[model samples]
Target chain A: MSAPLSLPERLPAISLDDVSRTYTSGGSSVAALEQIDLRIARGETVAITGPSGSGKTTLLNLVAGLDRATSGTITVLGMRVDGTSERELAEFRAHHVGLVFQDPHLLSGLTALENLVAARLPFGHWRDLQAEARRLLAELGLGERLDAPPSRLSGGERQRVGLARALMGQPELLLADEPTGNLDAATTEELIGVLERVRREHDLTIVVCTHDPAVAAFAERVVRLVGGRVDGQQRLDRPGPLEVRSLEER
Target chain B: MALSGALAALLLSGPSHGYELHATLEAELGSTWVTRPAQVYLTLGRMHRDGLVTSERVRQETRPDRQRLTLTDAGRQAAEAWLAGGPADELVVRLAVARLVVPDRVPSLLGTMIEERTAALHRLRGARADDTGGFRAEARDAEIRAVEGQLHWLEGLRGHLGELVARPRVRPADERAAELA
Candidate 1:
């Protein structure tokens, strides 16, 4: 018999080597991020923190293939992300990344289930997509609100719907920008718990950029950015012995 | 019991001196749990007695000898059990007792906690955004929900206590004396 096909070893979820992004307007050039070298391993959770105008979003945009770097290389999921055509980048993103933003930007007219269904429609049959969307929305604690329009849902609920929509594509890497910025403290905590649970369930690699220490506390590693450069990096010890439980036990 | 289990779990990670273990636990738990060094040592002693952990005295260079503790097979199993178990119910009992004894202060205490947590959440929200992607955003959302749940529970508890206990209305002694006059 022919040798059974084996899956390739997982590569770094993201790698940015000497990456920089500069924007020029009116004969003045502003460097958003300068020479950032970062490698995030598969399934690792990292938080990038800095002050405003510190190029935090710039770094995320680069990795998501939303924006090309002005210089250097960007690799995501073992593919070159820095030098790809727009069409190629779009395909790579659709296949490998799930993006969440401050605003869910969900269609206001669509029901929660419909919103998720819309995200998956391009990739699967409508019947299967609708079932998958229902499953995701239910998993995200939106089972009751599945038929509710975005306008009727609370800010937190809408965000959860957005998250479910993101998962509809089943991207390996999840990238969120200020996902909790629109939420109050209580909602933020609930969303964080949901994210953690989802991450564990999906076996995903996640990168979040935030100024909040409370949010950073959830990350295994925290990278500090300042003036468009990496200032410091620290590995946060997982809190509590309860985390020692095996995945099956959890 | 949780602390003892936590200590054992730490050992399961690898062998370390008492002080090192204590530091690691403190770092891990942060302000969530206040762990005294003495409590850690006491638990270590108990765990050693139970044969859940074994210790070896290592002679240091120009320093005091330290006991390097390691988890035994039984200890590893016990640690896993502890990890799988739910949190203690003592917290609920303690809160119930506090509600009875100090009903008036309960709301204020809860309010203070809510304020602190809200401030922390806002601080996190205000932190410079980074590109780590959707995972951190998801993590933040989870945190927001947790804090919101606590606030909701506290608010509900406050309302319940308010209904159960009415603040006593007392006339001032001077007012009574004036009325007598």
Candidate 2:
């Protein structure tokens, strides 16, 4: 007898088909990303990596709806990011995506807890979000310094606050650009640890654009872009942990 | 990288004693962290010497002697330092070595590695650690992630080197970053 089909409540968190972005300036044109076909399933983590102009951010921006692609379709949690109206995109971002930038731009005057709470201020009552903000800070190991303002926090602490702020939206998908661009090795490692934990706890599908291999390596899959094209991709499904096999050139 | 700090965090909230600490660590961080009791005790002995923690043997009736480990002021400070974090190095040296020696082979493997590393990272982080174990799971997760990161970086080195030495420039990555801004 055929078994009943069981499907996940939600499947791929993000889908991109023949996606491309070209910026035409004065008389010339530049392709930041070209023909990008990618899929990220629910609870997956993917890293987009490339050189300075490989369109890592452009690809991320397209999925985020911060920028539209010249061609192709981008679907995130069932919504069309490319063709959606600005208002719809804005709403989608507010409700579905969490963004962590290279540098977490926190309101200088606000305390760490306040910054997290304030991000969702426009969406809900301040009091309702306060507890969750506190929990996030504590979970990130910043509970002891919740009252500290951005100026008072260390580079690592500030980044943790930034992450906490991102989680405030409770979005299903997270997008980060060079999140560790500013941190030291030890701190970067620490932040990656936090990110790893949060993604699982929150059941988030994360897409990060980074130049750091350490950061990219932490993802479930790494997508490499060369000259704005999908040059190659690999899945880290091999057995063993911390196994270092040097590349023996063919 | 920061194993001591995490080891300290495990003892901070609840000063696990004897078999308790060893059992707790195993339960909280899973095999991704220190699993053996002897290793945990050895670490405790080192921590005892470092003044990050204090260890005491409390005898019980008809049972083995319980080792009570408590976090010291310095241990607490160490945990705090971990939270504050330190400056990061820009380059990953292992990958640099691969690029220096296996330049060609490095790219094919490296390009694939970035993908594999990402996947590796996802699976590592996706492993279930203790949910309510306070900072214990977090510290353990950090330790695992940091170690995995090193391997991933080493693999990724070739990919970047390949980009620099090989591959005709179809377009630069940030050529539009300036204009897009």
Candidate 3:
């Protein structure tokens, strides 16, 4: 087996302590999340699943530093995300967090290569970034589509490119919001395979917010959000041995 | 036979090398089907000899040449035939034979079997709970239902066995002989 991607031994990738997010509209306040506490270890794959309006996206945003919690603390990669300044959060996001939306959000006019290279521009010059982007895209099975624009690529291919773009920053944590929502069954399976492979190869801590059970099943653990609160959490059993030898022995 | 037939069907979709074939089978069948590299090679050999598959060696730069396997017309026909046939009821066959030979022990045996099978199914269900793949989910659901049906049948058999035991039938010759001895 390949050696697991080494990470800082004890520091968690994410921690949420009594985190809550509330939105107010028309003089009525709605809790998008309530007193949520969660910890995700480094290099772990977790899926946040629930019905619509269940706070899955809200929780993901808090972790990604895109949205601040109304109450409680959120720490990701040892950074205080809950109350961090926008500038600090932006810097943290640039270096440590990669986000993928339901739509790939790739530029319509940019080629696949350009989209990835462009994402790296904020970090530095794009000259050396091209080779890394190309390699990442190739690893995602997009080598042949390097010059193809988002309009020309299939949904699965676009998602793969999105995934490639996420890796450009070499982010430790990858947060995807409904990554496979638009894909067909075959494409969904393909995307799952790609995600699993990429996670293993790069040792990424992935948290995908989705309602699809299939997508949730790919994760090592699943946390169910219900009505803006954590309803339950389940650790999915990895595929085990073919036969339970004890049964036969008996 | 299941493994060979599955391999043939996989080849019908597209030609693949040995390693790729093993990976594909694992993905398709999940952890239920345990296929070793040797088993894949052995099955390929048999199929090749039987004119069901053909192989061509493709040279690699840094490694030894690999053989890519493709299905023959006969292989395609055989795979279709295999798919057309209903699955064998192995559990039924085993239970029937066990009941004939050890009627007294059938209830206990089946009880153990049911308990084990149920536990296994629960584990499988938990493992596959989040799987979104259509083929994997459908296959898992079918297997779960089959196990449940068996459990239901076993319960009924246990009830009937209880009634028979309660009827107080005459002791068999062996039992009588043992008592006299």
Candidate 4:
């Protein structure tokens, strides 16, 4: 594993410098994103909300180092995601970044416990991985589901499994892509609570790509994307629905 | 309802093993359908007893023996009926009424609803690209388009809700006001 890069003096957890992505659609190249500049600080949960074709997913892919930008640089965890080689990006993401796609994406073959253990092994560390995995499963109300296969799990349970998998590696940066898109309201809140717990416990830098303000209400900051650019932004100092407990209550 | 339909569909596709049917459903439903394999097989066993399908053990040279399945005539009839039915107009209910009913969230929810409709439209359009003579491509497209228009109207109403629910804000008395004087 690469040495943890020293963060810049007072630098944010993530910074995007004039990033843009273009794609060929209908025989014409369309700018999926404009020159987007944004910053997210450590332990901050930032939500990117946008309409379809506004490039919310594209922006997320760039930040998560899953895709490269057509232009400009993206600094995440003090490394340039835009210019990193594929191998480096994969390694970096495996160790420093965790992703929750819209779908749970759990391997059908693995049990809930095995799914998380698999995520840990790739980081070249399995010592006590099982214990960590079990703890996470317990947190998600899946203590009984440790041995259950994907087929036996409910829609919500499968999502919980996915969340546990993402956090198993204990990555500082967490990116979620519509993690609650398919969930019912009750399940969505449950999932959000799980996410909030993980974020606080790990002091994670979290970014969520969602169109739902209900989802965005969990974030400390909300950035609206219009035409692939930051249309508006607001810092949510007051507690939103996601914050259910005060420090004293906890 | 979707699961039962899927079960019938898979059985009709071929005499498939219970595990294969579960995998097929997972692939089709993406994230919405969640269930364990053992439970699915147990359900299949129940269906077998109920005369929906038949199951048998097949010898495997590799590791463990395999279970195979075949749909009965009744299963085929069920699948046909399911395929003939149109989409069910059911609202997805959740516990986040505070978020959904809250007036401030109206605009963003409306936007997301529109995005979902657009994605559904793309799916419909793409379905037509393959000349599957079995489906009514034109009718499906029209139906999806109608839903897309309705989502647009919902978006308009949500914007209005945002306006109606916003509280009156009193700006702080500014030093600039005294400077202007």
**All candidates: TM-score of chain A:** 0.90, 0.92, 0.92, 0.88
| CAPRI-style grade of the A/B interface in model 1 | incorrect
Off by over 4 Å in 4: A1-10, A25-27, A125-127, A239-250, B1-181
- Residue-by-residue lDDT tens digits, candidate 2, A104-216: 99999999999999889888888779998999999999999999999999999999999898888689889999999999977987898899778658868899998887787
Interface RMSD of 2: 7.0
Query: What lDDT does model 2 reach?
Result: 0.72
The runs of at least 3 residues in candidate 2 whose Cα sits more than 4 Å from the true structure, single-residue gaps closed, are A1-10, A237-250, B1-106, B109-181
What lDDT tens digits, residue by residue, belong to model 4 across residues B6-121? Answer: 56655654687866666655543446547787878777777788787877899978648877888888877765554443122211211012122243543454445544443444
Best by lDDT: 3
Tens digits of per-residue lDDT, candidate 3, A102-183, equal: 9988999999999999988978778878988989999999999999999999999999999899888789999999999998
Q: For residues B87-133, could you state the per-residue lDDT of candidate 1 as single tens digits?
A: 32222322332343345554555444433443444434333133158
| lDDT values for all models | 0.72, 0.72, 0.75, 0.69
Q: Cα RMSD for candidate 1?
A: 17.2
Question: Against the hidden reference, what TM-scores do the models get?
Answer: 0.56, 0.62, 0.58, 0.55
Best by TM-score: 2
**Model 1 chain A poorest ten-residue lDDT run:** A1-10
State the TM-score of the second chain for every model. 0.48, 0.44, 0.49, 0.46
Worst 10 residues of 3 chain A by lDDT: A241-250
DockQ of each: 0.04, 0.16, 0.02, 0.01
- Alpha-carbon RMSD, each predicted model: 17.2, 20.5, 20.9, 27.1
